[model samples]
Target: MTETETAAQSSIWTDEPFDVHAEDPFDRGSFVATVVRRIQVATADDPSTVFGLVGPWGSGKTSILDRVRSGLGDGWQIADFTPWSSGDAASMSLEFVNTVADLLGEKAAGEHRAKLAGYAGFIAPLLGAIPIVGSGAQGTAEHLLDAIGSRPPWHKQFADLSQAIQTLGKRVLIVVDDVDRLGGSELLTLLRVVRLLGRFRGVHYLIAYDQDTVEDLLRSTGSVGRSAAFMEKIVQYPFETPPLPRAAVIRLLNGVLEELLAKTDSHLDHLGLQRATSLVDALAPQLRTPRALGRFREHLNAFADHVSTARLDLLDYVAITWLRLNAHGVWSQLDSWRHELRSGERATSLTETEKLTADIWEGRIAEAHPQADRTGTLDVLSFLFEGVDVRERRTFIKHPRAMNDPTYFERYLLLAIPEDDVDDELIRIVAAELDPDKFREAATALARVLDGNDDALANLAISRLTVFRENYTTPNLLLLQFLAERMHVRVDEAERVGSPRNGLRPLVAREMALAVLAGETSAPDIIEMFGETEALNAVWMAPRFAEFRDRRSDLAEGFARFWADRLRSEPGAYIKGGRLGGVAELVTFALEPEETNGLLDPAVTDYDSYIDLAEGFVYAAEWVGSSYTYELQFRKDAFRSLISASTLERYRPQVLEHSGKVEYDVEGHPSRDIPPEIVKAFTVDSLSAL
Candidate 1:
């Protein structure tokens, strides 16, 4: 359906005060059938044990009790528990015994009830005026029982009555639900009451337990065995309470989503209805059975409670959960990245300084959670606010810095924008809908994420951000810092970008080689330099680090050089494997450029032999070249990549082919036909000696 057309239907799923137990003709049949059938078989012969309907918290257990009570009319007796929100199982036990007496006592032939009722009348009012004065309550019970039973002792009267009822063979059944709600001692006492009731052969007790809930009651009183014994004898074995039949669960869930959808004038068709029902039905078992459905649904209701005039289908509930989580996860990834940056990075030169790359998941990106997508709000993070790149050296990311911050009121402007609007103008407009502070804070927060997590996360964010930028360069300020701080190493301008450091041009040569290899756009002035746009894009989109890592070797060298210059300030890098014995190297390498204002300014007679040493490392690995060379393979790789294949075809020859054998054909692309082993060598040959 068209958005407008669908919105017009106005589903009731989004509505408030969802009728927790409104049985409908189409949906109630299955759930009610399961419940009724259980009750029928148990009580069919005579009054069997009250149908033990057991389940976990939020399983809509109370709703089932209400529905069964309503469905059966007067047939079944339900004496539910009301343990205080903080009440323990022990306290609830007294209520259990009293409830049993009240349900079964009145039907007893004789003055038993009148006596009990008289005691109840006086004691209840007194307790009403006072506290703990019920007929069977601990303090007032003994006092009132003697007065009402008219016996010297109250226990004698109760035991006599109990024995008389046992001899008569009258079977009485009472159901105690919400047992799982009580914790600690109160729960044990409730269970104790059931076992005590087991003393009378004709009396039966049905109790409910939440499968997912851990009963503090059993452990506290240390009477779980007693409760188990009662279950084994008085209660039936394997009291399996299956899930709420799918249709009924759907109906109840639909009731939950009612108000929000109702405002939009949405009525669910059969297809919509089926989809909505199945959304809950299928997911209820996965998150942890139907027992926790209410808690799960409660989260949905709380999130969507403010959403008015929205289409509240079953998926709507999932959407709200999904959106909240994605928004939070993006925030977390950004936060983690921010915490990992260098001290200086925080002051200026934000990490990524590029466009935002926050991931806005549109569906359940993790485990099976239908509610995660219920509200259709998953892509909310994809929106953007004001942004601009200032001073090629220092990037400033912010929500439009107006005197009063005009962007604060942008959402209202969006109403004027077309619904089909997907560009920055539209995004800026919708952003106005959100609180300006929220948008600004979230946006700024997203940018710092690039610098987040120091170098490690910077690399990952750079790679991911690169891919995102490729799709759309206009992405707002999000996760920029995460990509920036780690991936882009800021080289201090004080470092020499000139010719020859000592006899070693390896440093400047490599930098020159990288600058040359990247196009003219990559030329770093005596100021800040980020990674190549192409390289950054490749890093973001490529699935494997190898694919992105393949291009990053040159960029990494530049970054390393920049830092090497900075380290000269204290010159503090841990020394390893050298004649200097890991001494800090303060000297900066320089090389003459042959060209000016180019990717690299290379000059002539600047040949620096690859230092033949024990070893030189690249990233996480070391390369062992010919004649015990300590040269990094990246320099030659870049120079060769930039030079025409014919320039060094012999020395940097096509020694091997892509097929891994010898490439006898010198006519092919120089690197294309080279074998793996042949690909490693760097030739000293001159292509104009280039």
Candidate 2:
């Protein structure tokens, strides 16, 4: 009823050929004019001329014939013959003769119509007398000759028709299309009939076919090198279809893309127009014809409707879709590459099979797209598989930039990983869990269905927790914590969530504790599962918890006390096992507004312990000064308390000297610089107090 509804109902890509008389979208009118002129010139010189229009399948041969017929106007009588639709050679011959007679009879009146019917009668008996038609062919031919009483043979009758056509001052143009679609026997029979019946003086023939295929068919009759000679004898003038222009093809493709985007409910802004332009440029050389562009649209229509919700990179999705349609072997190899990249062994180090598969895929690309730039095409492959080394053999490693980007990683999984790897039911369960409104319901439903008997589902749910971590929305984080809690409950009941030998309880528990600490979802529940020490340990290792700690000091202090107790019980372990690094990180999280200055007394273990405490205090001071500023005076007082007058005198010169150096060779050391102003503040504050 509405304009939008009407537009949506129209298809973006139709499988049918374009209408012959429609406006030319590809600027093909110039070529059509040239072809029409050539046909007219040849037919004017000799009315019996046969013109052959040669082109590949789906290369607009039929459209060209229609244009040529239209260009000829009322000067000639045109009989359009579709030989392929006739089913058999005999039927095709009959259709051709009957169509011409009808056209001619319609043009002529009274006496001329009677003359044309007389010629048609003479040809009918001869056509029936052909051996392929039926039995009693010789008797029927003899009887027809006797009845006519010395009437000329069928060829003589056709000559009379040609003479009658000339006398009537009319030229007949017979257009035959898709001759290559016929079988070998049917093709030979049709050619023979055309050579015989199409030789009238005032009649011209325009036949269309793929020359290479017809030549092959002729060669199969043992003609070998003489097939070209046979074609020359049949056709007076031959024209090969020219290559469609690249710019024209791209313009047509863009039109199709715009239509598809308009019809679908997708976030089109995410499909970067610049990247799509680059991809279209890359694909232009391979899409040599209009039909190739149509096929690409068909494949895109099938796969790209869900791209907005799937959150796939539009460039990567288009590249993969192109490969799936054009180069199937390369697509299969890329799927395998995705599988290996997800595997633990290949993630850490490349395997022999992965190396071989990459090489095979490169070779296939070269073979399939010889005209395309190999390096540029492989760049698309590199986008999908980060570790692919298209140039060198031994230096294959994942690109660090792509490995760290979450968007690129998500696209790789969405496109490369097969649906069967994670069953549809499991994927549905995961998707439902990720929804904000459905989070609680999906979690409860999964807990009921997979409490004890479904370890596989539980493990799948656990494995996908990392996927949700990248989506740092509040609702998504809450759902991540909820799913982790459900899995922990299952593990607590002694259910086999993972392999018995590996025991998934510890891994799931660690993830669950980290989720609570980073999400600040259920701190007490986290402490119950991993106990106080292990819970604090897991939180210490998790990244991006500054916001969580800033808002929840009560939870932060509980973890900090657990860390302090561990340091007190095993002071020697803190020095020997390099645990001071962990202590430094924990102190930063535990620093609060109320009691920040008093927390450092627990760090006094020994004389050397004072240096570690001062480092931890300086790190925490820098963190608070840069990140947290709610109570600035209290944080400054906390920094002065950790370093007394004597301790400041002891460490100030060492800290300043280390900071002055341009570079240091120490490995796994802190690289953050403590501002000299903070150290000077500590000394001046102590002097002021004195």
Candidate 3:
């Protein structure tokens, strides 16, 4: 989209005033008309009356002033003097006189324009530096001096200007706006210009200001006594802008919110609307003016750009954005305590120190939002961070996209995925590719991709599949079989030794495959897929499938036949690579004692072959607790069940000679070898009796 289209879709307010009465959403048209009528009457009756339009800052004072100016009928001379634009007393006074003269000269006849310019030349040099207005100002001053025949006294010049002003057929009104924005000297200089220097027979002043801010500026001058009394002497008639109704502000906010939500095509359900309404109502005190609503729109618009708003809990997002903008201290606290605040069911009781810290945090939040209701704020916090201590009337629904989910809390705060974290896109792709006909091609394409750490992206993909397994349909064994084989590709044992992030892909893939099989009821379909898979994959998966075979008689019978055929065809492949360890259960299930001995006796004749066979029974111990706890352990029962007593006797002398005392330290020795326990299990563990 183009920039204009994006801006058109946004609900952010620019905070500009309405240009016409038809644009008044705050019911200020009648107010503007009334103020204009009073100014007209006051200027007509008293030639030099001072009318003051007063209100607090940002209370639509400028809008009302503009509307009144636009509503007035023509034929009156009006000059707008913004004293805040000038930096000092000299510049402010010079700019004010020039503004009035230039505006009046625009419509005056040639003779009357000359008189107005003469009056400006007479008064401006006395207030500030000469030749300051522009290069043409000097020539005009010299011509005015020649016309007067010489430089006159100050009082005499004032009298002459007063007489010349009465000749004009129009009443002159000088509108000085935002006077409260001036500094001490600049403000005093402006008041002097309005009440003393510029006050003529047919000139009137209409000034818009915040009464409180004007008084404060007057007092800051340190020369004025009783600032309010001083202002009364300057402004004869004072009126405050009309009060803005709360309902009107609420209506404006609702309109902006509707526009924003419409762009997203978001509609809140009944409960969602109720919750959002409650949150907005709780913030009513802060949204009492057009400027406040504009600021809120700006903040929310920026927030919506960073998060997944479609899946977001809309009410929760709104409340969070409000807290971030208005209650900054509380937002910082939320960020610091995010882990504890978004945790699931507690596993243990809180310590006394932890409870005290929580109480202190609550007190700090209350102090930050002192004007807000304690119950309302806490309820909002509780809803957004579910672990906070607040009860709900109904069960809380889980939305992973919401800020309350622990997995998503950092994503919301950081506004991007962390480096080690898995992207939701991978999970989405895995879920989409569950079709049996397309699984192999998609899985193969995905497995070749690498992550930032240069590891196979398939590891993270399979891990995500394990986490979201329930979301998938019944078994897609082809995908599972592919993952099983891809995961078993050898990783450097030294690289995986101390780092928990490495070398667990096969385990995750195995668990995911089991989870898929648990949902499958067709035994023959699973057996056929298993038979078609590579020998390494089939053997790697056999133990897990055997776990459920007691309830599946067809699997028990079919797997035995499949295992016997693979062994008869290529038994040496498993023996040479130490993969024979994983298929021990199949060997015992499929072959009789004599058949197993005949197939294995010749395969284990050498020391290297025996070690490889023994390596199958050994597993790297679970890396838990610490590095000292990681070592190789052998399953003696599985080894004894497969290797016959005669074969054990034949391998005993070589095992005793080659396998010395085993060192089980993983940190000191990162490499793995067949441990002495395997040798003992093979030669001296009552296996000969068997």
Candidate 4:
């Protein structure tokens, strides 16, 4: 769909506002209209009533304020000034009076404006507001206005101004907005001044402020405690505003999405606002309440391109919706389907059977994008598998990842996983595929299924590889050593093995850990890599070090000492530089270092990231009992996560298990000789991802 449409589709997911243009169909709709409704309600009378409007920092709070102030009803004085934006204390009282005078002129139309100017009297000079209206219009009006503005104890003129406003209306409601934005002294002045002004009895100072401001003041300046000492001195009623309710928020989501969708027909067209509304309602808790609906509004509009075109196919659209609907389903965990399949008395036999079928397809997806995970697959997979008659357990290879297609996972893993609603059909496809032999065949069958052109699986195939038993067995041992050395951890003594990263990224330092799983990088690499004093010192106080410190402080400290020594020798590490852009990126992906990005000079633009990619001239010195392949046998083999033949078959009879035939059970099930422990250990869900 077009860019405008994707918004309608995504709108159901969130309720936040977006940047719809002035001309968009939803711009003037009931959704936005409601936000302004409260403003109008308070401003509609001859004498406006006091009300508070609060929202997040960037949530268009000021826009509502501006609209209300401009459109307030006739014969009402509005004294609204945001002193916080200017960041000054002295000018605040003066600016407030100017606004009050302006409002008085607007409310009176033309009657008392000149009369008001004449009355600024002794209040003018003291408050410093008179010269602002007329340079030297020296009289009681000027003097009084300035006096009131500068706050020079002008009880008489202040009461006079309030009484004059009351003559125009029953009472003057001073709308002091955004007082929360001002710093220290300005805030105190506003509260104190407004409190003193309220002494006129009928007038009210309506204000809105973040609780954080007052809370911070209480924390830093003991305002809360100090104010308690003077509690009796202040006479007033305090009605703290309550937060918006849950159901009202859902209504807010509906109003916004329904209104926004009317623009391009994507939301209503693709998922129907009803279902969209349902999805949004369900997300309140996950979206973190308060402004959930508003954020939905924003996210919806952002992906407008995806939503509008979604209207073309009803099944595809609903299928997509169903996935999001069941986002927290089986695909949420690797053992979910197995856990259910293994369950009996309460199990949905037909349900389990159907879900099992979907899993067969999932295994292919896993094989295809070995790097991918099962999250997000239920949506598209549910749609694709929904109509696929699973009674006979027929197999078909649709886009993988059970809920999300392989294409989505490739992109998703590079970022964070979006919480998706999932569909049931995904589990069915996976169940049938999990029957080892069938799963293996179906996975291999995909090469023929797509005729090798499935666009979604194309990128995924880079990690999905076929292993020949003849070429695998004992030949690939060096890969194990290589992996072991790099990870700073040991690989088992067992010679050879294989794995893939097809669709999603590896989890838990998995980029580096996958090498360990595939026998390419060792755990020791992690240990020894950190053992470098120079490398350790380079990254000691960085924020990314937080997780590394928390998770494995022992390893991190070793690297810290190693780096300290390394840096001490050089004294100027990065200043004595070599390119590290790739190392920076790779390590970032691997270690997630928060503060490791030592900046480069603005002029040095062409940075290479391959600082450690140099092919094996080992950095260890002889003192560490490490010789240059003297006693050690060095193999001239290139390392890759996936298994290969030439590199393996030469060393051992076979480097990995590449045989087409593994012994099968009578029912054609692949032998569990592969070991459930091994299968279980091979997490379809990588922990590193979380």
Candidate 5:
């Protein structure tokens, strides 16, 4: 690509420093002008002066130097030197002297060039020998002073060279940058040259470095408490790079986001645009400097490209990017949590160690980016995961629409997984609409190919079922069965409302039951397609079958006969098979009140069956209260029948002895009221009858 094209494609928050002569995007021109004025005033009285630009790494130190160089007028001559490029301390000093000589030669005419070259030649050998002076070489500095005293009146030659430059009335500015990047010895040597050797008339030095690093380096070299004193002697003026304003940082971030969004063909609606803006505003405080903002934008751009921003939840995307940038430890923790949440596990309180780790990480982030509002970042996390406890601060997302949407968490998982391993076919399938026949074909093919190992595909299938539930005209038995089995594995591991086994299966079964009652399908056909467990599931969830009894009485009658035969063959097997809830649901459609009573009457005659039936009644009572009143009345009648006057006389003392009180108040049976007769059957009055 051409340079223009490349620049067009580049992120607006590029880390490269702005050209000094270019338009200042950060509005740093005024600051640069002020520094230039100070340097000019300071050097007016003193011919030689040094100014230090102090800031932390990636704090725009070099950019400030560029601005200073660009601001100087024609009366000044400037040479820029980076000591880090030179190999050692000796070589750096030699390079500095050579650069000054070359600048002087370029400025001077014929005879003065010869004079400047002689002075440069004389200083070259002495600069090379300065390294030995610290190594205990005998007669190093003393010998150099003596040698200078005897040779060609060297002091007069230097003075004449200085006067020649003074006659031109042009001040030479030597700019040395990134001195803190050098080794301890190299840094000290560069300081010595600027402070002691290069102190010539009509020349000023502007050096830039991180003050703390250079001071620590000096202290490590035996300067200890005197490092600040030494720095004061070398640097006449010092200035710290000012913190970039929060508004400027946000504007730069938004500029990059707009560029990225405009270049891609992604469809961001009003909600997506609002979320993107909120993310930028939320993270604006943490991005204090130009470089930090650049790094954050870099991460965001790469993630957007990797995940493909089309139809994505921009808020979740931003949250994942922030975690990746500032709180990577938390990012890893969240990835693990995603798997756990997908596996149908409940989110419990954090363990002590986990709590400690989270606290330490939050503290680290807060300390590193004090300008950024960490509370906003933590709030993003809480929105993504339902139970993320960021200390005692309870954070909830303000956008309820985004939080309610399933795509938010789905997009988060897409970014959390490795890019290479993402199942693109599954993602496409979940997002697209499939007809009943196509859904059955695709679901069956996927189940056959995957053999149940890929949880990502399973998750996509479950999500697809929700979309299909509202749109598909006809129910697909094969698709529903496949999803049920896949979800059953997760349910067996842990039963949670988020699990497809517990959450989607009932919805799937209800759809099938509706098809059967509407005569769109049959019970035998359903049983043939899915197994008995699913057939039972369909009958269990179709309790409203009575509403369709007038139109489909034949199917209701057939269903009641089928369930009656099953109950007679296995007297208490339905309750033992963990279908107590389904049995209660069947009361409204399949089983009559008399049939239910007959099914449980044998339980009162048999002691072992009575215990199981009693437990089933307790569960059924709880389950039926949430159903239609007819189902509740039928379950209550069955319970009252089991605890008849004679039956209660035999078992009431055993029931009272085995249990303290017969309490029927539980979660599912919110308003379940036990019959006063049944309550009296198990009370102290029943013991007298026994």
Candidate 6:
């Protein structure tokens, strides 16, 4: 496999506890060393002692115990007791007693082993009929039975085991981990074994558990006193695990995120890094332990694999994945609330209804997660989405790569872009290109993506360009020229393609070109640049630029007429498969009365050319209220600018031949071409002939 392929499969983080000093990011080793020294002093003074290592779940309790065990000298014998492995109280008592005996017997030599077995024999018959659960337990049970054939009274047996432990001259440390995992009766039984039955001279107990969990279990077991009082009686010297510093947790989190970025070949820019730091700060309260950080890392790994991380805003990706893992209930409703969230992104953009909805979601999110720190989660939500709290007005410049942007919002939530939507990476490639030819080529290629002859992607692309408009260069002017001619085709594509988030407008291309030129050059300079170009779009642009001198100046009129005359020079550009929108534009802004009449004239002999001309009178009516009463209508008002009423008399035979093919229902909905309304309107006009 290639190196790149191998790197993709490798993991950069793990949740396993650190076993060595160097791997201890929490400075736990020093604490462990102190614990070890304290145990040595406490055990030297008393033959048997119980020390409780206390913390909440995932707070590294086991790690501390492991370190303390390693810190002890060779003279110490360690026996790990896992009470959860046993099914009942009897099993737990029996297994624990045997564990101590086996530890002593295995290390003791010659007469010491015999003496250890003799001591174990005293307690063998007392623990009645509990099934042996391990090989060590079986061996210890047999050794105890063989060493002493007869059983003694309970007190005498307890005394014998205690004396034997004192005489062995070896220090024993019994480490019990995750004691809180045991059930009610089992937990009470294990505590009884430690404090009463199994307490022997020179044997020390280091019990690790979450104190809150242990106390809660003790209460459920019908303990007579307060849970803390019972725990205090059993655990003489209790040490609570220190709370993890918020700064340390964030530092560790940052290091892990940086490693993940490197592993995925993704990097954050200065702004991205700043946003990430702020998000981490906001998220620190929930990320209270190494285990929580590990969970975040796991989520990040899955996100990196599932989506194109390089194309997303790093801050948004990290924030979203973290929210999904930690605040699942709120995350579940994000897609449904996308519209409100998007409108809320800018305070000025929100309506009163949307503002009310945002307030409702804020309260709802906090109510849904009552156990969470309400203010902290709300703060994170505010940071994640600007619209979540319009009153705060946390304004920032919007970017198309942000998950909160309406255009890319679905891509973030779904982890894939829609077919008609252009990817941000593709936009970046065109934006970054410096060479004029290459940039225009890339932009042209983007323009070719259409949905059944409608320029869907081009509309979406131009809408997304607002975010990257500041990155435009002199070479980007070519894009302006390219879009100018095609803007008419892309006008209604956003609606047709069902991309409401595109937010397209009729003059978006013209406005975008003006924006691109705001700092680079003046309006007159654009005329100088494209003055000699043969491109029709350039000719269309020249008059718009000339308007800067005066809206109706002679210079602007000349430029408008020049565009119309140029169109007259090349009639096929309009007559052959061309959009009629161009001719409407010329009549509105570029043509004189005579020139409009001349340009509107087309070949009536050829069927294709005649149909193209006839289409100027055909129109598809939009829905009124809810229903479209007239599917197709032909109105003379649509042709008023292009042709005079007198001119219509010249095409009487052509209109009649096409009008004879008309078909429609009584309500005037056409099945196909040749609108019936055209024949009705034409006959009425002929009766009152000019």
Provide the RMSD of all predictions against the true structure, rounded to 1 decimal. Answer: 19.5, 12.9, 8.3, 26.6, 10.6, 9.2
Worst ten-residue run, lDDT, model 6?
A: 500-509
* lDDT of each candidate versus the true structure: 0.35, 0.55, 0.58, 0.36, 0.58, 0.59
Give model 1's clash tally.
83
Candidate 1: segments with Cα more than 4 A from true spot: 1-21, 24-35, 38-51, 73-110, 113-173, 197-203, 212-216, 224-230, 244-334, 337-690
Which regions of candidate 6 deviate over 4 angstroms?
1-14, 105-148, 306-310, 342-362, 390-397, 418-422, 430-449, 452-462, 465-470, 476-690
The prediction achieving the highest lDDT against the true structure is: 6
Instruction: Please provide, for model 6 over 338-420, each residue's C-alpha lDDT reduced to its tens digit, 9 standing for 90 to 100.
Output: 76565653244456243544456567677666555555556566666656663564533354377777667766676667775
Task: Give candidate 1's TM-score.
Answer: 0.37
Tens-digit per-residue lDDT, 49-149, candidate 1: 53466565545555455555555555444454444332322233334445545655456534455443333333333332322222343454334433553
Q: Estimate the lDDT of model 6.
A: 0.59
Instruction: Show pairs that collide, candidate 5.
Output: 285-372, 286-372
For residues 118-203, could you state the per-residue lDDT of candidate 4 as single tens digits? Answer: 33333333333322223343334333444432332356555565566666554455666665566654555455444443334444
Residue-wise lDDT of candidate 3 within 1-690, one digit each (tens)?
Answer: 323323433544577665554467677777777778877775433458888898877777777777777877685777888888865444554566567556545554444444444444565555444222333423343343336434456677666666655555677788888888887656776786676567776778889888888888878868678999999999998877877777765665565566557644667677766655655555665665556656777776666644443345555666677676666667767776676666523334564224323344456578776654455555556667656654332123454456776555666555566554456654555545666656555555555542223454435544555566545535555555554444344333234532323333344334444543575433234444333323334434435544544433323334445555665677677655555655665556554655555455555767666666666665555454544344555656556766677778777776665543443343233434545564345333222323
> Candidate 1: worst 10 consecutive residues by lDDT?
579-588
Worst 10 residues of 5 by lDDT: 628-637
Q: Which candidate leads the pack in TM-score?
A: 6
Report the C-alpha lDDT of model 2 over 266-333, residue by residue, as the tens digit: 33453356545655666777676667766787777666654544544455566677766666655555
Model 6 root mean square deviation, Cα atoms: 9.2
Candidate 4, TM-score vs. the true structure? 0.36
